[model samples]
Target: MRSLVLCLLTVVAFGSCLKLPSSFKKCDRKRTDFNQCLSDAIYGALKILDKPLPSHGLPSLYDIEFPDEVATIGNRTYGLLQTYYRPRCIGLSKPENINAKLEFGPLTSTLTIEATYSQLTVETGFEAQGTIVLLPVNVVTPFEYTLVNPTYTFTFELEEYEKGTTYFRVIDSKLDMQAHGLKLDYKQLFSNKILNDEFNSAMNVKWREIFALSKSIDEDVFAPLFGTIVNGFLKRVPVADLFDG
Candidate 1:
């Protein structure tokens, strides 16, 4: 009886000492990478928006109101905005991206935008990919505007898996006013510009805060399930210093 009890205890100890599978370990690593990538991506977008750009001519349109309904998740309340801008030159385009702004009262909190693309194939299967970009569009009051409006364009290929989708979806899109016959009042342009600037600034600050919080949550929640994917992908590719000062 004594020998049997000792044997059972030894077996239990050995079982406890068994190592986790290599794939599981890889997964954990990848998850960490994924969380890091998410953080970097969010922070990177914010950095781009935060960089001081010459405030040229007052925005073509003004006072674009955001949704007032606040969403509370844990200790945070989120506000959202939807806008669409039609490119002067267009070939083919999808709807606007969903731009999310989070707030805690007068202080602006966070800004995030999400867009999705889909590709359908009979042999491979339907694939959908979504990208969420977080940026700080801080609005400063008394914002001076120049008469010159600079045109900007950005293009990047969607991730490999996402490229296969047949349909593309853009959530929370922003529309350019010139196309819609919307004009800004020259007299109220300053005040409107200031308000808009201030709003964007507040949103930018909020974005940074929420992004940090989200990364923490993502790390905790998805680490086990998707860490390996993140790690593997990052390891194979050269990491870029996107947000480096």
Candidate 2:
């Protein structure tokens, strides 16, 4: 979920270079409709990123493969211990109602973006050995999670980096997300069929509780990962060239 969302931000932050594909539209800072233009440009850019653009340092968003991610539900005192290995995510809906704002300052700048995505689906191998809701269970099974109508807000703080030419690098970043619905499916909870079915049923019924419990993962895992990847590409092109004067 983190990598998928930030990939869009990477495209939005990329500067205007000569090698860019014609699909990307640049907005002028002096224009009154700059925000609307920025939103339109970002929507168009994401649509054409179905294939990797090596010249632009962009990867295919058709399927985003992520490294093993480990996260715990609660502290050692108490909570469920959950882990996900080799998660593959797809079905990233095109962003809608996109709004992008860039506040240029003398020393630094801030970029705040708000967008809504229709859906995102994730499938991963899961392991849960610890206690969940006072249930003693150890399970290793394939997990599928889906988010419906998720809206995300991202704010990036940028500073100038000089590499012969002045470029922008993300110094800090924050991400906030809310979803209308969530679907969770993992069949094998225990060796017993009855227990397995009941557990899976409970999870599907109570996914909102799970989401609230794991909400911190956004800040803990997503934000830093997003900042690093955005900065990696954002620093390549001169800041002055990203927008029209």
Candidate 3:
């Protein structure tokens, strides 16, 4: 009877010693274990950025917008341009990926991806209304721009923070994407191919400015849309599901 009491006391004492601190207790698993699992899950999730993209057709993300802007028209000169683009439907498909890499870095719980997409197909119908100045004249323009096959490359960064019990919110995220061979078929408000050609030639002279705008669109527009998709998926799956049993 005495030996039985002693054994019971020992078991109780050992269990008590295993008790975690208050902060750690709040989580579904030990902090280290949870972090490891989350890292692996994050790596897997980032790779989906390269996967076959489905048509995203609802919510505001499906509708892409480009606002009024001004850019250099040519060397040593600036052009004033105003643009409004509203997409009725937009979707991405055909992921031909050359390579992709995902890294879960320790600092700030950051997830970084450096990926290259060989080709992609973008389907869209958007009202594009814009007027751009070359030097002495404003070129009036309005069109329905639709596209087919496009190619892309991207660099991405996202930060993760715990929302509650095994769920996380990714914030302050940014994504940069570049497009190539994207042909926009235009159904214009007015037919003036020669004037449009002149505008295009002027824009080509200031290619650097257009390039900067592309990066801005990626950061200011596409980043949040991508976060919604990624973080929404993360919230659905439990932290336990991230681990290898």
Lowest lDDT 10-residue stretch of candidate 1: 119-128
How far out, in Å, is residue 178 in model 2?
0.4
Model 3, 1-245: lDDT tens digits are 99777656754753211121122212223445654554344334334433333332112322334232222223223443333343232333223333333345554345454433443323223332232433343333343322223333334454444433243346666765565433333334325777556555565555456555554653565556566665655554433343333
Q: Rank the candidates by lDDT, best first.
A: 2, 3, 1
List per-prediction Cα lDDT, in the order shown: 0.25, 0.71, 0.41
Instruction: List, residue by residue over 1-245, the lDDT tens digit for candidate 2.
Output: 98766656655665433323566787898999888887787767767766666665555555666675655554423666677777665743266567888888998999887878788777778787767667775778887888889777778999986654578889899988788888887856577888777877878788789788766674466666667656755755566667888
Model 2 segments more than 4 A misplaced: 1-19, 74-80, 131-136, 191-194
Judged by TM-score, which candidate is best? 2
As for candidate 2, its clashing pairs are none
**What residue runs in model 3 are displaced by over 4 Å at the alpha carbon?**
1-81, 87-91, 98-108, 120-165, 179-190, 197-209
Q: What TM-scores do the predictions have?
A: 0.16, 0.81, 0.48
What's the CA RMSD for each of the models? 22.7, 7.9, 12.2
Give the clash count for each candidate. 43, 0, 0
Residue 212, model 3: lDDT of 58
Error of 1 at 28 (Å): 22
Decoy 3 TM-score against native: 0.48
